[model samples]
Target: MEDPNPCERAKKWLQSLQKIENMNKIDPREAPISLDSSNIYEGFVFRGLQIDQLQEGRALCTFKVPPRLVDGNGIWPARVIMSLVDNVCAAAIMTCDKPVKVSVDYNLSYFSTAKTHDEIEIDARVLGHKGGLSTVVVDMRNKITGQLVAQARQSMHNLGGLTVTPRSKM
Candidate 1:
C-alpha cells in the first residue's frame, strides 16, 4: 500500500538524499536540494523505481517495465525511457548538495528494447559540476541478460533564485 501522506514520503526521500551527501563528506557550504512532492507528474513517472544504492552524485535503481508503459508491440517506448533517464539523472545529481536543476541538453542512444515486465537495472552518475551546470550519464541494462538497453548524457542548469510553484489541480 502506498503512503497516505505525500509530504511524509517526500521528507523521507529528502533525508535519504541528504544522507548520501553526508556519507560522501560533501562540502558543508553547499545547499541541499529540495524535493517537491506536489509534482504529480514526477510522482507518476517515478512510481515504481526502487533505489538500490545511492552515493554522492550517483544512484542505482531497479525497475520492471510495466504493462501500462509498453506499446502495442509489448516494448517500452522511447518517450518513457527518456523520461526515466531524465528523472533518474536528476535524482542522482540531487545527492551532491545542489539545488534543483533543469535539463538544458540531452543526448540518448538506444541499443536494445525492453519488453513488458522485463527487469532493468539503471545506473546514473554525475560526471561533473561546473558553475551552475551539472552533467550526468545514465545506463539502463537488462538484469538477466546484461544487455544495454539505453544510455543517456544529460546537462542541467540551476534555475538560480527561481521558485517553482506547483500547478493547481483542475
Candidate 2:
C-alpha cells in the first residue's frame, strides 16, 4: 500500500499502453478499410472483400462488386478481377498478420463477362503454403445470379509488398 513494486508497476503500465494502442488501431472486424478518396481503388468506390469464414486451411471471401469498376475493352478487365481475387487470397495467407507476405503469382480464369454495373463475389481457399510461397484457389461469381463466372488460383511469395509496381512501357 505504501509503495508499489517496480516490476508490478512496469507490467501495469505496459498493459495500459497496449490497451490504448488497441483502441486507437483500426478494427477491420467492424468497419470498412479506410482508403483515401484519391486512391486508385477508391477512385471507383471500392468495396471491402472480407473473409467471412475459414476451415481446413481454407477461407472464403465474399465481395459485392461496385457498379463503376470497369475496363477499356468494355469488359471487366482481367486485372481488376484479379485485384479482388488477390485481396481475398492474400487475406487468407494474411489470416494472421497483414505484414507477413506479398502476392507474387496470380493466375485467373474468366468463364464469363460482366457489365460495368454487374455485382461479383470472390471466394478463395488456401491450397498450400511452403517455404514462403502460398498457393490459393479463387472463384468469381455473379452476386445475384449465383453463376460461376470464373475459377482460378493465386500464388503469392512470402515477401511482403504493400503495393505492386505497375509495368511500364519499354
TM-score of each: 0.73, 0.58
lDDT measured at residue 69 in model 2 versus the true structure, 0 to 100: 59
Off by over 4 Å in 1: 1-38, 163-170
TM-score of candidate 1 to 2 decimals: 0.73
lDDT of 1: 0.76
Query: Model 1, residue 103: displacement in angstroms?
Result: 0.4
The 10-residue segment with the lowest total lDDT in model 2: 13-22
- Cα TM-score of candidate 2: 0.58
